[model samples]
Target chain A: MSRTRVLVVGAVLVIFFVAGGILIYVNGHQGGQNLTFNVTVTGATTMKPDTLPAHQNDTVTVNITSDTDGEVHLHEYDIAFDTRAGQMVSHTFKADKTCSCDIEWESTGHPLGTLVVSP
Target chain B: MTLAAQILLHGFGPRYDLPIATALYLYAAGGVVFISFVLVVLFAGDRVGPNATEYPRRAVSWLVPIARSPWPRIVGGTVGLIGFLTVVVAGFFGSTNAFYNPAEYVVWIYFWALMVILSGLLGNLWYLFSPWTAIYDALARVVRIEPVWKLPDVGVWPATAAYFSFACLELTTGMANRPAIVAIAAIVYTVITLAGMFLFGREEWLEHCEAFTILFGIVARFGPLETDRDEGGKISAVYVRPWGVGLLKPAPSGWDRVLFVILMLSTLAFDGISATPAWQDFTVALKGYWLPLGAFGLFAVRTFGLILLTVAFLLIFITFMEAVIYLGQRKVDLKATVSSFALTLVPIALVYNAAHNFSYVVVSSQYLIPLLNDPLQKGWHLWPAVASFTPNFALAQASTVWYADIVLIVLGHVIAVFLSHLRAGERFRTAQRALLSQYPMLLLMVLYTMTSLWILAQPITRES
Candidate 1:
């Protein structure tokens, strides 16, 4: 085989490996069932409980209704569900086993809550 | 604005143990030193010569023959390929989740390890094994394409620009998390690769980004690179004859040595700051002041201090290491030194691992409730509350205890650079020149660090 052919083959192989690995990682860590919940944001600009209860494989639906305009994000968690003034932002997350949910509202700087999952 | 503020301060700051922020700052400082070093080397190129001696002479004997063999090269390429595949697949199919999974820690460490190892052991080994590079090389051969229709006669700037662009991506954006971003990046890279192949041909692309090469040369300065020189019959009797090999020789000194010291020190300072707990409380205190001024003040003091300390410590350590290598009549192997230095990163990684897994271990397991309830905080809150206990020892040694690996990585480069630049005349080599050009970028990094610290200072309201 020509040197060029060898190089191309190597490149293709690398691309394939990288793509395959990413697929497996995402699939392996897929959270359990999809969930929908009604979330209401109340009290001093925070996310209230600071935590919630969900099963290891359960899906959560968070319906957030806030009186104020707050930006909600699960920083470092790759989860950011933003809400507007008096508007609601709903998000669904696959709950891992024994995980605590850190729901943060950036606008109010007060709404930091956690969701405790019961195994 | 408030949300942004909060996110910057309490959210990212206290979380991730503030190491990421510190790393970004260090990266910025390295940029500055790099630019300055390059300019200095260019102007003073005449003065620099290969006057330095290499260390661990026997190791070079072993490495040279092995380097000629294709096995180590192939193995290195395979490792890189695996890592690339994992990142691509995960980005595509991973379900959206709230927290960084503890399990994924293994993969993160793997990526970090592989990148460091390749860069440290073989200079620019990634280019040889890089899927991107391979693709570019292959395409060039088939199509006879070249990216640069007109090769600029001027030296280095074009490549430097390309590299800086990529570094910006690595610094500001989280490309790994966003599939769209990653895809776009991949596409852009492909275009650049093909363009380069079409214009400058495959060899140019291979030589373009040299981040790994520069990193290796810097880290293993005292090792094999020093030894693998064509001494050209100057001082051949003292250094070359002693090694019983043609490759081993002493380095000549000039501006390159000065610039090398500067770059090593800058990186070390950044690493030291990351390891230091002193900045944490200081960051908190600075935030109590007015936003803009507080931010600027914080940046000035913290970054300046970090740069100064890193440079001073690196200088001291490098001088000492060189003395030892010289006295022992040892020739340094870049690969071995880097591998040894890489050991330090393990500790830093472990610390981050613990910090990330803390919630899972403490809250979910119900093991640390008693410790959390200690009288230190004056009452028993919850495990999360108790975890905030900042003992002096923990803070003092946080980098060593939690992120020893990062410290080690930084120190490894310091020693490598010091040993490499110890020669009398050959200090202003190409690698040293390249690093000198990056000082401006480092200053920019310092500014960014200060901004981040300022963001951390914003007051958190009890409620929205």
Candidate 2:
């Protein structure tokens, strides 16, 4: 192929990739199912999966049940609420943006898991 | 963190990591860059393109006023000095809260990310506005500080050391997040920089020991603007040119320079890796045992890991260079190959920096105004009323970051391939031999592209 044709082909490929990325993002956000993660902490030991993935605008429900009362803070989402012992704290929110933030216990600096929300 | 790593970990955009998007982007970007490179080698590999480094200058005389006058530097330097002082004061006396402190944003986002970005885009604005340089310039005018002592013969090695050392501190200690530490570090750095200035002439110290100068100087080659000094010691015309043309010039021909470029990529690579779930798990598991060495032990382990990674990268790069030598059947030493190909890697580092931090800077920059209004948290609201104002994170969506990253990374690799192709063609005197040499480099570029995409695809601070 000529250099000019080759260059033109390269440009088209770029546009294709860009459009593909946008399409995935849009599809991820358009009315996805409500995703829930069941997290249980027993005396500082994690007995649950560490990462839960959700789409942007999808309802992300983290049901935290602990033997000891502690607070969980989502770093990127910048939201935190208290949890009580023997009581399940279901913190449900809209998954916004692509973020993989470390969820931490405010009292002990123990990282619980990750909230992976993507657009 | 060294500013780079922190921005990567705290990357703004999307709520979750998009593994699918990451995979698609990587496959597409890598495929396009690789195919384009092979085609270019086949069709146009024999000769230099129109934008070759030796091309004639097209004069735009209107830039004469700005280029001739030193006012831009003087004004910029003055503003930089004042701003530096504010950050220092804010770090020392401002609120302990990092979010409320202007110094945090100033140090990490503005000076760290923006400076590196601007250098790649606008040709080393640091030279015109470095607070350290401005201070030394003022002192030199009165003191007549000559290069009295014999300066170190090391070229860019000192900068590499300084960059890594600073990286260690940033990663281990909460320097970027803590106002007090940032302030103290700034003071210590200023004193040492000034002392180095007095020992060796200001120009010599800046050229040698200063990390930002050496870094910005290299990346400026890939930028659109090319500024040089005339024999009269006056800043020459702001030569406007196409991107990547400056990379063609045969400057920085030394082993130290090659090592410096390697270190730049290595440091950033480790930073990217350290953010991954696997690395985090290993570090966390190691930290328990390492803690016996005292409060500082875990940090030491992490820093050592960074050093080890850098060495690994160096080994891998050298092996590629050797492959190129063998493939082309050229009588060349490893050092010669390194010098010839070091400029090719500049685009990768530049794009990586942009892709890693662009969303974070664009989205998080909104915090600066509110922080600035009540910098010390003195509770005094400035008239700008930017306080209490928060930026909607939706502006820089996760999809946007992915798109920008894929485009830039693919483009950077293509440029790098083209650069190596041109240099190889020029050297071998035949396009066929040049193409033969580039097969090795092309492999390395594709690998590098895939590695970068993989890093971005992973979770930054996952609890593994």
Candidate 3:
């Protein structure tokens, strides 16, 4: 009985390991979707919609209009674009990395919002 | 400065782990519950009394002579001293910009994040290269140093207090990322440590009062390598055992020690929770109440939250310990059982630290490459190749980090359950009593496991 118990436990663990690996691989490699957002920096650093979401491997584009002259810097992916006061600027990049990365005002280092790319 | 340079200096900016998929989270949680049940089914009836504290250790006698030699100490001490001095000097005299300053990266990323993970995986390397001990040992060689005063018998409470203060510095004060503040804190800590050693003996102060010394020592128990001392208190032999087995050794018993262990877990969890949107909302809601104090209000709110979280952890753990004692129907001392069992929970802390900081460490430590080329920010091309190298953010992709986080969390709880069972066996004697006592412990592990995963899945946000 003890020997049988050991075998059963060992088998269960192996099954769990294999299944978990396959599930993670499949979940991670899902196809991407194109996403776009129009973010307005109305106050010195406040973003209209402070949080942007996208799927992993998605093509992400952001159109920005700011009240002040500063650059919008997206962290992790290291994408950046300059915005003049009252002028619209657009930047595009593939969200290949999955992270809830901060979008910040480059000069003041104030966080404007977050761009979350999920798997 | 360029926008890139500004982003680089903003080292304390929001770092959010890619939240794990809900499906994966559910799978991992179910796996934890199922694994605990399987552990009981397989090992529940095995009775091993006092021998439960015993695990196999193989001594490498060939390495003993080399390990005891002065060469390792000299090289390790010199490197440690250089690293410490670099942080202090760069912090004080170097560029105010943290991008070029090595102080912030060395302290926050390298020492706090990286070294902690290394100690958990590779034994107590910190013991070999701790700058404070290295400096003391070097000084002792030149001058005869002895204790002027005996340290009071406080049972690690001083270290606990020191650690709590350090945690506040890292998590609450927001000063760790500033070069001048980091320098001042280092100089002040250095004076306190050296003064303590001058009054009390070196070993006594380190063992009872020094925060990192106690912390790294606890974390190193999960590592595979261990040392055995001779009658004269020198390392006589080096042994290699299985990871997580060193925790089964008889733990030093005290309420202070228990609180220290709980603090380790609570502080780590709090760091993760503080970054979540929910915690951000909670803090923002309470901000109005303390609005009169201005800037200090945010700091006070965070510190209060940290203390409250710690107290909640302690209360919950104690209640669970009582449940275990009551259900076991054995005449066990609550204090003794609680203290011994507290060490078993450390695996969870270790993995949580590693999992939560996985991407942060990977991405942040890369800054060291460029910093190494021009650590003082004088624009000297000391190593041009390294200075021009770009950081590889793609190394920690969201899907990959999520899998790593879930696996680490699950593995940690499984180990915790195993350690708790062994501890219960030591206390309860009979296999049945031991198994019964662990029911409460198993529940606690499952609960903690879910909480860890839940924290990992929360959206990251800055504290208001």
Candidate 4:
């Protein structure tokens, strides 16, 4: 093959990866699954199951139980709830958008978890 | 299908939280961007844009007019040196909680992520604020001595290695989690920096060895204001260049610089990748395979993968560049083409970095508030009045993050396309040939753009 042809072919080769990525995107949509995630806050800085999967239209629920009295904020869904020691508080909403949002304890800047909502 | 294509598409599976919608749009928009770059290169002709307009002419006007005096240097440099020393000491002896230690926030969030973003936007403030440079300058001035040794002729290889090492330290290790390690790392880095400065003159060492110096300098090229010193050694006024126009003057040259450009992209690529579910899974899978080799084997395998990914980035870039050269019918030497066009990736790397670390910079940095209240985690309180201060992460909304992410990525990619077009125009004699030469490069940019966007949108999994 001519070098120009080879270069064109090589550029075309990249398209396969691009196409695969796009295919992944085009076929991927989230609005149907109902999911519940249990997030246990370990300390002032960490959380168990630090990430959870949700969809934009699904009834996604996050049940967070902490060892300390602090508020949990779900940033994308934009909700906050107060939690005392040893109680599992649940926040449920439409996943809204296929974007990731942080769930964190307000005071210590400790991440409670993340909600990876899909479209 | 290539192994990579299958891996990129299938590894995540349908259950994986890939940002399909975002990636799809990126693919389409990126194509449009590719065409736009082509048009700009072909028909737009030989316009070098506008000359840089100099600003207020009085940046150092407020500096108390201590021209060529050591007092200003001593005061500024000493404050920075004391701060660095304080962080090292605090790391060794302070609270074990990385969140409580000021060093974590100061180094990782403030210096690494936030300041990098600011430097890209507002120009090289970090060049002035660099702790090691300041300390070295003060020492050089006080000792009244020139550098004992000469600088190597190596083109930015030291900086590439330095930046890669810094990234590995941040990504592959838990330096932020461990204070003593942070202290040791800080000490080792300081020693190396000081020695290098002493050996190869302060300015030469910074330009060649300092990672942030190179990083902030590159990003500053895109910034509106630039500092220039004329032959008379007077403080030339800060000039406001047309957005990203300063990039046209100095493009990367030499093999080391080309590799530096590639490594710059790779390091950021690894940062984005390592944070994803896909990479976490890959590590988990590798852990099982490497378990027979024992505990250290796992670390060995992980490091191998890190190096492999970076090499893979190099391979992909050169392969594409080779194709571009072929398209241009070998008008430019391969190495020269690589150096000239590689600079176009700088803005993308900077923007991707900002997008990736947005949350960490915004929310995690909040821990600094309480840490500032008690830096040593002792009962010391410099600000007793602000003791009850609590950071609301909600202050940074999801829509806000999304806006910044998409906008910056798109803007940076467009700028990259423009930059490569401009550079190609400069390289190739004829504008038509230049436009034709960029077809492959533009395609490569689009591919990288989609990949970066997909990586950013990938769901954050638990760190393995």
Candidate 5:
């Protein structure tokens, strides 16, 4: 075979391999499920299981109970809601964007944890 | 927590991309890189392409008049000066909040991220509108400026040092988010640069000491534009060439040049690595031992990590260079071979940088839109329509970003492999020897590509 044919065949093989890989991987993550998490905020830190993981398009709800009056700010998504000292507050939204977002205490800007939405 | 610390704890913006899945994508990228190497060896074996001097270039003679006109320089220089002044003034007097401050957006996003991206894709605009160079040129007309002292024959080591420090400031200091700190740092840098230019001479200082000049110039090599010069060192023609072909021109080789290029890759890799959870945990664990140092502990730890990564990169690169030398069994000096081959790796760096900062360039740069009306944020709306402009956060979706990053990273490795094959063909002067010498480099490229993909797979940040 000529050099050009070899090069052309090599190029096609590469495209096929790369495209096949992505298609297969993406096919596995087709649907999303609703996920709810109850989080406790003590002072500036979040309780155990800090990172809340969800999938793309999943409706995620976080119930926050804090000892201090502040707001819970979910970055990237730009969603926030107020939380009173003794009352439970919940924020729910579709995990439309896939990113590892920082959930911070809105008043002090302290990081409470991460909200990872995998695609 | 201080607001600046809070704001900068994760990043300047809230646009962290989803990490690419490593299992399938990493292997796919590696396979592509390997296959590209095989294809190059099979097809391009032993034949050198036209060297830089002999590369085919069709001069656009009509552009000579436009290129020679003084209007471009005058307008470009004025704009540069205005931009520099605006950043300084706004940084010092603008709102304390980084999100509201245009200075933070201009410096970090526009200049740091966007400018580098443009320099790689287009030609280096920094060459045309570098504020410091413009300032020096303007000052030279008013006063009979002359170099007070001669610059020694140091070969870009100062630039390497300057670049290292600049990277540390961008990555480690955590002060970059503070507008006031950015202003102060910009002022300090300007002062140092002006003093260097005045004492050592403008061209000398810019070539040897200025970090961005050297950096943008290097990235511009892979761009499509080319300025051809006559034997008299005057621009004779302007032409456009294929991207990545300008790298085929034999550039001056030295250890310092090699390290500068290596740092281009290592610093970009370090940016991705530093944001990973493993790095965060390691720093936290080390903080206990450094408690006596107070707030300086984290800063010290980060600086140490940056230096460690740079050194580690240098050593790994040298080992590969040795492998090439041994495999080829050529009488070439290791240092020369290393230096020459270093330029071939630039495509990888450029693409990695583009991929890593894709979200910042697309999404974060939009913050400048609203700021255009009230740059200082005192309710002075220069453009009322812009005042209501909201950044489109979804412009860069996580899936889109992940796929773009993977494709760009793989493409960059392929380009690098092709360039190295050409370089080997030229250097070894025999097809068999050139093909043999490339095994180590091909392996190195595959490994580096995998590492790049792996970094993308890791979470952007996980606060242990």
Candidate 6:
């Protein structure tokens, strides 16, 4: 090939690769499902209970149900397990003495919420 | 990407918490030390005399003797090659392992030993011996096969641009991204090299910046410019010389110096403001909009500073060279000039040492560990080594901020010493001596080292 032709071909190939990477990233994110949860704390404590808490070595079953029409993953207390639409998933977390056992929910294109734990 | 975009994106990363008071103190100290050291060197005169010219003459003289005894070369080269390979492997592939491994003493010792051997015996000999520089130079030569494009005759600005751009990358990016940046930098360098070759041919690129040029010049001041001596049994002072000697002289006016100082101050100001909590919050608040503007402002200031510094250095360098040449031609005593410059390096070394070690002093403190451990989860936040040292007092917990403040306090002394040493000369040597006598900071260093060791020995606790 002529030098000009070779240069042109090389430029095109570079652009193609970069464009393809971007496309893949965008599509993957778009295709991922969104999940939402109405997190309410119910425990016997003399405090305004909007957040859940557990003592050291205490196991608490976190009941999660998704209202949205997509799969959502509950990344609670360092655990990443999924919950399907209209289905409730109960996750049990053992609270370590050093860390407060708080639940967090993560999904595509949505804000993340934290379930605060206090001893 | 746009420069603004790049800066804004980079600002999202962690920053070191250095306070205004601490910075001012350190800056003042550094200034004093640097000026004092320069003055001292200036007054000391050339104690070594012409016979003490050790670079090129000794370099050549010792070579034959060393050639006769090859064991030193073999052993040195072997150790160097091994260490280089190990560092490359560890830095690239085994960084996590190296980071986690508590036995960092081995690496430290290896590096210190290598640096000492190279600097002491070779004297900036790493220019020739460094495997990385060697590889870069070789690749640069290889890329000359296709020399189609040419850079404009901007002079020094291109190199200055490259330096500051690399500095930005160093400050912002993780080590992993540096290789890519280096590759891009290498390409730019190769282009410049080739352009120089095309424009000035071989002499411009090789003779001017050649490793042996300064060495030869230093040797020539003592006796000979080259091995070839004259009919009168005297070594010739002039052999080969660089072109355009007139363009590379002292500035015509004092305004140049004033401009340079202003530029430097502005750059430092930008650096200072960027490190402030207000700057961080402004960036975060502006997020998508004002952040880019801030970044652009920083880049502009940084570039301007670098350019001004380069200009100042060039002016000073040219004047010094002219003085040397004039003295050499007249056969006047030139020993004092060389000695003064050599001694000036001491304060510079101290300042650099203190600046580089500041991060270690800050990070290894007793305060940072607890705050880093307090965050739950093994996610992005759990990365203590990454998140812990951030200077954002608002974003970071109180404990981290408190620890950072303490570090700043210690760093202030280092800066003060640096600045004070700058003015140290015969007139002020007594004052400098008095200052030094008052505080034997070496004892503090020893205590700090012991404390660090104790801290490292303690098992990491998850809970504060």
Instruction: Specify the highest-TM-score model's number.
Output: 3
For each of the candidates, the C-alpha root-mean-square deviation to the true structure, in angstroms, is 18.6, 3.8, 2.5, 9.4, 2.9, 20.3
Worst lDDT 10-window in candidate 3 chain A: A1-10
The order of the candidates by lDDT, greatest first, is 3, 5, 2, 4, 1, 6
Report how far residue B9 has shifted in candidate 1, in Å.
12
Q: Which stretches of candidate 1 lie over 4 Å from their true place?
A: A1-119, B1-56, B59-66, B71-75, B78-114, B121-124, B137-150, B173-176, B209-464
Per-residue lDDT of model 1, residues B94-199, tens digit only: 3222012111221223332233443343343454456555554445458655355655443334444454344333322222333334435545665665565566
Report the error of model 3 at residue B277, Å: 2.0
lDDT of 2 by residue, B134-158 (tens): 8877776787667768677877788
Candidate 4 lDDT, tens digit per residue, B1-464?
Answer: 00001111111111113333554446545554654554453433442223211212335443334434556556656766766876798888887666567776667777777888887787776665778878766566678757888886877888888887877676564344566777788888889988988887888888888877887787787776656667997654445555566666655578877777777787778766766778867877887677777756645665677788878878888888887677655367777668767777787888888877775676666657766677887898888766666655553444345545665676677678767766766666555666677778888888787778878666555442
Instruction: Name the regions of candidate 2 deviating beyond 4 angstroms.
Output: A1-6, A9-19, A22-27, A30-32, A35-50, A60-66, A88-92, A107-109, B1-22, B29-33, B36-44, B48-57, B140-143, B172-175, B281-291, B332-336
Which lDDT value does model 5 have at A69?
A: 84
lDDT of each: 0.38, 0.70, 0.82, 0.66, 0.77, 0.32
Sorted by TM-score, highest first, which candidate order results? 3, 5, 2, 4, 1, 6
Error of 3 at A115 (Å): 1.9
List, in order, the clash count of every candidate structure: 102, 11, 0, 3, 2, 27
The candidates' DockQ values read: 0.04, 0.37, 0.49, 0.08, 0.39, 0.02
Fnat, 2 decimals, each candidate: 0.04, 0.37, 0.54, 0.04, 0.31, 0.00
Question: How close is every model to the real structure, measured as TM-score?
Answer: 0.41, 0.88, 0.94, 0.75, 0.92, 0.34
Evaluated at residue A18, the lDDT of candidate 3 is 76
> Which candidate has the highest lDDT of all?
3
Cα lDDT tens digits, model 5, B136-201, are 888888998889999999989999999988887777777777788888888899999999999999
Candidate structures ordered by DockQ, highest first:
3, 5, 2, 4, 1, 6
Clashing pairs for predicted structure model 4, backbone only: A25-B20, A29-A119, A30-A119
Q: Give me candidate 4's TM-score against the actual structure.
A: 0.75
Report fnat, model 5: 0.31
Q: Candidate 4: lDDT of B401?
A: 57
